[model samples]
Structures are given as C-alpha cells and as structure tokens.
Target: MQQTADRFPLSPRLFSFNYGRDSSAQTGCSVLDAAFKRYFSILFPEFTKDEFFDAWSEPKSFVVTVSVKSRGCDGYPDEDSDESYNLGVGDGQAVLRSVSVWGALRGLESLSQLVYQDDYGSYFINKTEIVDFPRFAYRGLLLDSSRHYLPLHAILKTLGAFHPFTHIYTQSDVKRVIEHARMRGIRVVPEFDSPGHTQSWGRGSVPSGTFGPLDPTVDSTYQFMERLLKEVKIVFPDSYLHLGGDEVSFSCWQSNPNVRKFMEKMGFGKDFTKLESFYMESIMNLTAALNRTSIVWQDVFDYHERPRSRYVVEVWKQGCYLCEMRRVTKAGLKVVLAAPFYLDLPIPTHSWARYYNVRPLAFLVLEIWKSEHYQTELSKMTKAGHRVLLSAPWYINHISYGQDWRNSYAVQPQNFSGTEEQKKLVIGGEVAMWGEYVDATNLTPRLWPRACAAAERLWSNEQLTLNADLAFPRLKEFRCELLRRGIQAEPLFVGHCKHEYDGL
Candidate 1:
C-alpha cells in the first residue's frame, strides 16, 4: 500500500458510483446490491436523492468504479473463495477491483475507512493505493450462543462489524442467521458440542430414565447422532462441523448399568477415556459419512489414537497449548488454538496486555509464555507442514478499561521463532466471544473495536499492523466510524467524535 499526503476532497452530494460490466452483474445479486447501498448510505447518511442530484451540477464530483472478475456473486462464502482486492483512490476517481464479490465487499469496507469527515463537516480521503488480501483464509469469530441466547438481529449486527465466519453454538433459528450472514460475506458454522456439553441437549427431550452424554452404549445413540448430524449437514453448507468433544465426565457413563455392562464386555474396564474415544470415533465417522469434515475439541485428539487428518482439533484447555499444537500437527491434522483466548475466564482488570503478548506457538508458564521460553516446542510444529489456526489474544468479551484495543492489536499470529515456510502453517485466527457474560444488549460494544483489532491482524500485512502505537489514531477513527454505522462501539479514550451524536 502507498499513501500520499494529498487529501482528495469528496462532496457527499456529488460523489457517485460506477460498476464495471462484471461487477454490475455480480452486484445484481440482492445481497451484494443491499451491501453496496448500505455502504453508500454509511458513507453519506445525510444525503438525500434530490441533494445528490442537485450537487451533480457542482464542478468536481468523485466517482468510484468497482470491477470484479467473477460474473456473479455466490450465495455464500466458502474456504476457497478469493478475498484479495486492489484499491486505488485518486485522480477524481477510485477504482476497486477483486477476483470475487467477496473481495469487492472487503474493498468497499476499505474504501469506507478511507473517507472521513473534517471539522468543517466536509469529507476527504487521502490519495492512496492498497492491494489488500487476508493473510488467512478462515478468519472467524466463535460466538457461543448456547450459554446465553442471542437474538437474530444481534447476531446480524455482530456480522456487520467484520467479514468473518461466525461459529455459532445456538439452537436459535440457525437458518435465519445463516441467510442474513450470507448477505454480508459471512459463513455460519454451527457447533452441536456433544458428549459433554450435552447437558443442555437432553434437558426434556431425552427418555425419562436415560439422559446425559448421548448414551454411547446404546445403538439408539448412534442412530440419534446420525439423524441429528444429517440435519446439521443439510442446514449448514459450510465444509466443517464442530462436534464439541470437550470436558466429558465419566461418572455419567460409569453410573449407568447398561454402559458398565457394555464397557466390561468390550474389555474397557473403567477407562472412560476409551469410552470418550469410542463416542468421538463413532460421531466423527458419522460426520464423514455425511460428507462433512469434523472439528473436535482437543480432548478427542489427546485421548484417541491419531484421529483422521480430516478432523480439525480445537485446543481450548489451559495447559501446554504448544504441546497440543505440536501433537496435533505431527499427526498430520489441522489445529485451532483456543487455550489462551477463552474470554469467559475471570481475568483481572487491565489484563489485555497479557492477552496481547500471547504467541500461539510459545510455551506457557503459569498460563503466560515467558519471552525466554519461546523457541522449543512451539517452533518445532511450524516445520511440521500442517495448517494451524491461532485463537489467542482476540477474546473480545474480556473487557478492560482504557485503550485495551491496543493490546489486542499488538497480537500477531506468526510472531514466533519460526521460518517463513513454518509460519505459513499459521493459517488464521478467531476472536472468541463466548456467551457466558455477554448478551444482545452489550454484544456490539463489547465485540466491536476490540474485534476490529483482530480483524486487521488477520487481514493486513503482519509488519504493517505490528505497531499498536501507530495503530492508535486509525483505530480511534474506526471506533467513531462504527458508532456512525449505529454499532454502539465503545469509545477509545475520554473524548468525543467530531460528528458523534446521541442515539447513534
């Protein structure tokens, strides 16, 4: 990206838009068209149709031309969709080009960020050129809606903050949120989280005498899972399904007479880890048969012997995260690191710096990786040649006073002692907002601006985004921008946006 000191003045009334032939066809999709108009209104909310037409009579009018290589927009974003875009702003015109409609949408967002209002109520953008692409293909946010129900509108509002694949663990109208998310270049991956978190699953629906952990001893259990997962595969079009195999208590299985009988007959004497392995293997095989890949909690990988490479393990436990990463990647499986990023933990106030300094591939000492304990187990996995996703440092639900976003902005996924080829294994990361303390009311403010930090970290060049000090001013501006978009983003400092108003 190249930026100039020159500020190109833009009149909200006179600014116009043009679409290249392919882009016009792509935006013809209702969702892309709505997104385009939404961005236009966001850029100039005060302008009316008449005002825009009347200002055309004025001399200098800025026009933005959008070009897309893809002929039409896809119904939803997939892992393979290209999100790279080239944006050029200057010469009375701005050109935004992308290989797909997803990239075009991202370019539109960058364009919106460039345009800002002056103290005199006029808008201007600096002359700049940006060839931007996401560093990782699967940038996401894990929203655990199971703990606290999130309304559809709240979910949609969260989607508006970034281009992400929302990992939703809710029973609430999944199809509705999926459709709405698709409109904004977002994919919704639903997680059922069984064998442990199944407490909620069997509430009133299970047979009166039988309940908890899906009853691995019963043939009906496998049948039930098959039917449930088949429905999940049909409802969610994404390639991966999260079958949460975390925190499974053996007492539930041990207490049941039928399970005890089955275990003894199978020579699995009191070994509940084996029992969990049995359950997870059956479910995973069921998932594969339905033609969907599985993402299980790290426990499954640890307990089971070499889960198939198709399964993605999410490491969320508190100890030895680097060990878990190395173990998983060594087995030729992908891993998503979530140990250091659990937002629901009751961390003390002003701990964002601790979260910021967390390097995914670093060793841990008392839950914090010391600078000296860096280049051992963590660096070894990078050379393993398997994809890894880092979920540390972007736990947006963990709030802190002052400029906590600076801490979040400081986290770099590849900020470890590894070669470039090894670093490439670090695919992407997610900002986890587990729904324990968060609800619809505070969701937007809690997530935004903070999540924006992770969003940039995942999208922009690592070096360009490394300096939190340099990012402060731009983030402050972005926080205000979210406010203007009615996002209710929390303020960065004890100050006011020049154009900020009440009820926005």
Candidate 2:
C-alpha cells in the first residue's frame, strides 16, 4: 500500500509498503539520538522528557536510523552542498543516510511527516523509501524588519517554521539568531536597504532635519553607511546584503538645497535620479570593501549608468517585471523575482488559487516586449544565462475574515509554460513576509503553513503541483504537525490537534 499521507513538495522519488507493525526511532550516535528525543518530546509534550529519551533509545516495531557522513554543525546552510538523503524501511527498521548534516536534517523532517498519530493515539509509519533533494540552491524568505521590528522571541518562532534565510535587523539580535540558526542549519542574511528605505534610519546622524531616503549629496551619508555596514558585517556573515533601492521618491532630494549643491559638486546634473544611481554605485562599492555581495531592488537600473554585474537586483514592480528581467540579464546581472510574489495584498477569498497560478519564468517576450530590441534581450536572458528567486505568497500578515490566505498551501512557484531550460533559470522563490502589518503576536500564524507551501515548492519536485488534491491533505497534516510541535500556526479549515502541544 502507498504511504497514507504523502506530503507536498513530494519527494523526488518515493515508494511505500504495508508494514505489519509500528517501529521506534533508533540512532547509535548519542548526539543524533538526543536530537530525536528532543523532537519527539516536542511532538508528544504530554509525555515526560525521560519517556521520550527512553522511546528514542529503545527499538519498537518501526525503527528509523539516521547516519550522516559528517557530524558537525555547519553554523549556516551550505546552499551548494548536496542536500539529498535516502530513506528505506524494511523488516521493521528504517535507515536515513545523507552525505552532509544539512541533508540529514531535511531527511529527519521528512521522516516526521511519514509518522503520524492514529485514531487510537498510537504513532505509526507505513513502510516507505524516499530519496529527496531540493531543486534550487537558495530557498529563502525575505522578512522586512525595518518596516515593523520583530522581537527576538517572534524571530525565533519564525525561524522554527523552516525559512532557510531571512533579512535580519537589530545588531543585538544577530548573535541570538545566529546561535539558533546554526542548530537548525538555517542561514541569516541581513538587509540594511540603503540610500532608499532609510526613513527608519538616521535618527542621530547629520543632515539633521532630513528624513526618508538618505541624502545622497551628503559626505556624512557615506560615512554613516560605512559605519552601519561595518556593524552589519560583524553581525551577519552571510554572503549577501540587500541595499534597498526601490520606490525611492526623489522629490525629497529635488527639494533639498544642500543635496542639490552636493550633487552638482559630484558632477551630477540637477536630476535627483542620477543621485539615486550614484548612491547605489557607492553603496555597492562599500559592500565590496566589506567583502560581501550586494542585493538591491531593480530601480537602480533607472539611474545607474552601468550597474555592476555582481549585484543581485530584486525585481519587485508588478507592471514591468518582464522588462526589468530583460534589462538585468542583458546587462549580465542576476535578479530575484518579487513582483508576482508580494504576499501583503488582501486576498479575502480563493487566495491559494491566485498564488498557485504564478509562473516565475512564463513571461511572453512578444507580448511584454515593446520593441524587437527588447525581444532580443529577453531571448538573451533565456539562452545566455540568468537566474531568479520567486516570492509568490508575499506579505503574509494581511488577512480577511474566514480562511486566512496566508495559510493557503498553493504557492506553486513553477507554474510556468517555459521550456525546461527556461524553467531552470528559476533559482527558487521566497515567502516575503513584509512587516508593514505584522509583529510579535501575528507574525507566526501569518507565515507558518503558508510559508511552508513556498518551502515545499522550492524543495520538492514540480510534479506535486499538477495535482492539488494530492498536496492539500498533506499540507493540512503538516500544519497540524507544526501545531503538535508548539507552533501556533493558525488552522487552515477548522480543526484542532487531538492532543494540543502548548506554549512555544
């Protein structure tokens, strides 16, 4: 018989059998055994810690043995490392083996889904074999803390829900998160969105009265940025930092006399657009000085005469996504897609279907392109080389009465009609839980099983998306499982775990 609950992002390959009896989770490594004990304790909070330890240590009818090639924590997810694992169960014992600790962590998560509580309250797993690995290297979730700061505890809770990377804020919070992420094999990337998105910044700095985008004309602006980047480098060791450069209102700079004077001095004309570009180029230089890659919104293309190929531009404008993709790739730059992925929009109904229809690489060059030149550029992006990250279920905090769209399990990132080569250009997608309407109390449920939808889409094969009936039940179970482990991720339909696990 097939596995009773085949989950979403269904394994690249899986086979099932009817095991006559249940089995225990077994591991020879003390560290691995302790980890499973902790996991089981969370899943069965009604049981004492000692009971979990004994159960994990002793073999029952259903046994799972996990063996990793290496046994050290990686402090960060090795995006390029092999995250593939093989799980096999026969004759009452199951084996989970991976070449890396990261893969082992993934396998453990999969195994947890395989085992579930029956109506009689006993836990069991049908005999199964699963070999799995993620299709994309960078499966991330971009949470904006600048708009509305997320507290440390809330941040930790969000981390537990399987976001591989998030744009972190607060210098003091970095060490706490880094320590936690290391144990979970998640990496924390920081975004100090400079030049623009600085309205929240500059409380104690020069250009005293000015607010909003950084005054690009001020010499002190660069000094302030350098100081901030210096602090950010010390806190976040991730390879990339986002220097936000989108939706900048140049009216502030255009009206400021001092800014105009500085712009003229720097050889830029009176146009504030050039100042925006100049600021981005200078910030990219600063990021390089700190030995880090810079990520920015695509608007930098509007003013920057020649954007560096190394910077990763996040394409966020919905109306002109294809145009931006062509421009970025034609200039030999990388891009991440956030247009169709904005999760903040209000979806009072059928939200899952909306997110499910998003195809990251399905843009029609002939229709979106204004000219033959634009078409040629699009072709170049497809053939030459380009990769993008998709954020389908964008701002998760916004919800209506009844079912919250944020919890929908329909974020199909690969719903494109492109050829296989074109589809390959999609690096992965994110759950952009922008904080404009989110905070401590609401962030977890806002992102939970909803973000996991994106997670499975990024990690699992494309085949699962073809059939929603097959994926939804597993998604519901996954959400309940998360609840079982003390995650207050709100319910999708309307039911509670038979045994509630309380208090994160």
Candidate 3:
C-alpha cells in the first residue's frame, strides 16, 4: 500500500530484485543515497531499511504469484510477469509486499522526497503481478556539457542532485523516488549531453570562442565519451541515453565549407539541418547497437526531416513548444517537458507555479507537416499514446550569488495548483544542474539542502504550502538539517526578493 505521497509506508514486509539478475548496488552511483537517508531520518526520525527488510524479506510465507495483470481499480486483467515480489504470506490472504527493479529504485528516490517520516513512500506499490515495461522503447535525460563543459564529477553530481526529485534513478538513500512512478510503472531514463552543449565539455573551461560540433565526426571524442558513458550507465540501466541535440551553434559547419561540402556529397544537400540529422542518425545507430535508446533534443526534427517515432525530444525552452513538441506530437513522436521546470531561472515564490503549469503538449497548435489545427498537443499525445516525462533544470547559471539555489525547491509546491490527489498526476520533477558556471569545486554547494527542497516537493505529498513566511523560519531548520547530513545550503533570507518583486 502506497502512503499516498512522498512518505514511506510502514510495510511489515520488503522484497528484492536485481539488475537483469545481478546483485543490488551497495554504494556510490549517486549522492542520492545520502540525500534519502538524511531526509528519511528527519521525517521518520526513526526506523531503518535494515529493520524493515529484516521483517519483510523473511523466507517462508504464503505469497501471491500472479498469472494475470491487474487492471486499474476497474478489475480487468491484462498480461503480466509471474515475477515474485516476496510478500511474507501469513493467512490465505496475502499482504502485498515485494520489490522489483522499478519499485526498489523508485523507493530509493521516494525516500529522498521525505514528505512524511513514517510513511516513507511505500503506499505507491500496487502488485499487479505481471511483467511490465516502458511503452516507449527509449527514454533519457540529456545533460548538456557542451554549453558548460561539466566534468565527470559534475555528471555524477547531477545524478545525485536529481535522485530525490526524480524516480529516474534510485537505490536506497532508504526510500525510492520512483515508487509512485513504478507503482504505475515507468522507466528510469538518464542522459549526458555532449558536443553541442559541449562548449564546456572540452579540456579546460571552454574558452569563449571555442565552440563547435561536439565531434560527432571525431573518433577521439568517441573514446572520451565511451569511458564516461560506460561508467555512468550502471547507475542508470533503463537502457536509454540522451545525446543533446538542440540549438547547436552551427559555427563549426558554417566555418568549414568543407564540412558543408561533405554533407552535400553525402546526399544531404546543402542544408545545415540535414547535417544535423546526419549526426542524429549516426548517434542513434551507435546507441541502438549498444541496446540503448537515442534520446535527443528537438533540433533533430528539422535535422532529419523524418518522423522519428523512436526519438524522445526533451523540450528545453519556449522555442521548443513553438517549434518541436507541437509538430513532433502531431507527427506521432514522444516527448517530455523541460520548460516550466527550468530551475536555474530562479523567481522566488510562485515562479515555479507557472512552470509547473506549463503543460508539455501545446494548448494550441499552429502547424504540423503543412497542416493547421488548434489542437491540445498533450491530449493528442496521450490519445495517440506517446510516452512522457518531467524535467526541471536547476542549472547554476540562473541562480543568484548567495541565494540557496538549492532552496529553489521551496518554490515547487507553489507551482502546482491542485489538491493532494491531483499532485499525484505530477509524475515527479528533476533537479537538473546544467554546467554553465558550475564545476566539481563549486557544484555541490550550489546544489545542496536547498535542492533538497525541490526534491521533497517533487516526491512528497502536497500537504506542504508555499508560504515564504512559514518556510523562511523552517528554511533555517532545513538548511541545518542538510548541513548535518553533509550538505550546506546558503543561509535563509526572508522575502529577500522584496526589493525586486515588491517593486514589480
């Protein structure tokens, strides 16, 4: 039984799963584990995963093995896996308890949400008893390093930063972010952007003038990325990788007439968009060969001039809504919203409220493949049945000098205009740390306890309000709480935006 929000439910039982059959991860794919444990202790102030698992995973018991898939409270059975979840059975009736790859990972993330201590997010589990999988074969989060050129450490830090806020990846920290997600069951997709957003990915801090193609055409670049991806993939094995492909400054191609000529010789004509599609197809093939999905940003739409059903276009800005997602959705492509959740663009109180309300599909469409229609894009998507996910960017560039960029989370709940029940529809949010001004040295501080606020808002119940008056005082306790957990947040300031917002 799920506790209904971010709170972990007291389950008398706990089960287990493996990576396609490997052992459970003990440590270090993300800082997420620490984030979860820290928050769990604060909320519950007691109880441990060890204690719960000890009782839940007990060997011999009556359990329900499923032969059919349970329908949504509608009682219609669907197909499912007979995979066992280990609920210790006592009487003829079985107490639903068990963990699979999806459930366990999500629980790890949910624990980080920390809405309530005792109910650390277990209620989300619904044992349907059938094998489930993602509808879209490919799902991913593309972290742009080209723009800010973040290091390996930053990438790891990003995964850690997003842990609690997203069920995209989890493994204890003691609860799961994906619990609610996995209960409904979704895939955990992660991405590492390079080349285009790679102005920052080159050697030393990318010099201002040194931006160009991420060397999708270079072998050396592949070698560098190969080692990086191999290491990070274990932390996120949902089998998708987002190769960021939006707004790539075509300077490299434009500067080198030979590069343009090369495209024309290759039958792509003289269009730079064709050149971009060449890059997309090339990467997709490489990733697909590795058994992963080629998730990219939206520029690929114009790049390929093909209806890419397999591609996942994560919309980064307003241009995406106007250009990509709307057209792509109409063309039968899957997508995710990254607009409203731009965590970097900090606007004190309800700034996120607008973002939270920024729906992924277009409320009205202007054109698609030469057709015109005023259609709700998201409805079309859900109707055509394409997969979707939520992305909230908390990159440092948009953050202020001393403001707890992490504290920006304090704004998320205010972002949602719904009842506790409706908040559940918010699959979850991601705390993205785009690497423009941040590096390993200053990264962690830029993303701590305050970031935890966003984490909590994403996974926890909507019970918390977005009142600065109430939160300002609590922010002190929370910041200290994070420091205690080894994360330091900037000191809290009440209505510091008064000078700015009050004037507005």
Please tell me which predicted candidate would have the highest TM-score against the true structure: 1
In model 1, residue pairs whose N, Cα or C atoms come closer than 3 Å (at least 3 residues apart or on different chains), thus clashing, are none
TM-scores for every candidate against the unseen true structure: 0.87, 0.80, 0.52
Number of the candidate with higher lDDT, 1 or 3: 1
Q: How many angstroms is residue 319 displaced in model 3 relative to the true structure, after the best TM-score fit? A: 6.1
lDDT of 3: 0.40
What lDDT does each candidate get?
0.68, 0.58, 0.40
Model 1's alpha-carbon lDDT is 0.68
RMSD, every candidate, angstroms: 4.7, 7.0, 12.1
Model 2, 56-116: lDDT tens digits are 3333444456667654543356446678888875556667888766777677777766765
Q: Write the per-residue lDDT of candidate 1 for residues 311-377, one digit (tens) a residue.
A: 6655554434455454445444454554455444455555544444444434333223321121222
- Candidate 1 matches the true fold with a TM-score of 0.87
Q: Which runs in model 2 stand beyond 4 Å of their true positions?
A: 1-34, 49-63, 70-74, 160-172, 204-207, 262-267, 302-305, 319-331, 360-387, 400-425, 494-497, 500-504
Top-lDDT structure, candidate number: 1
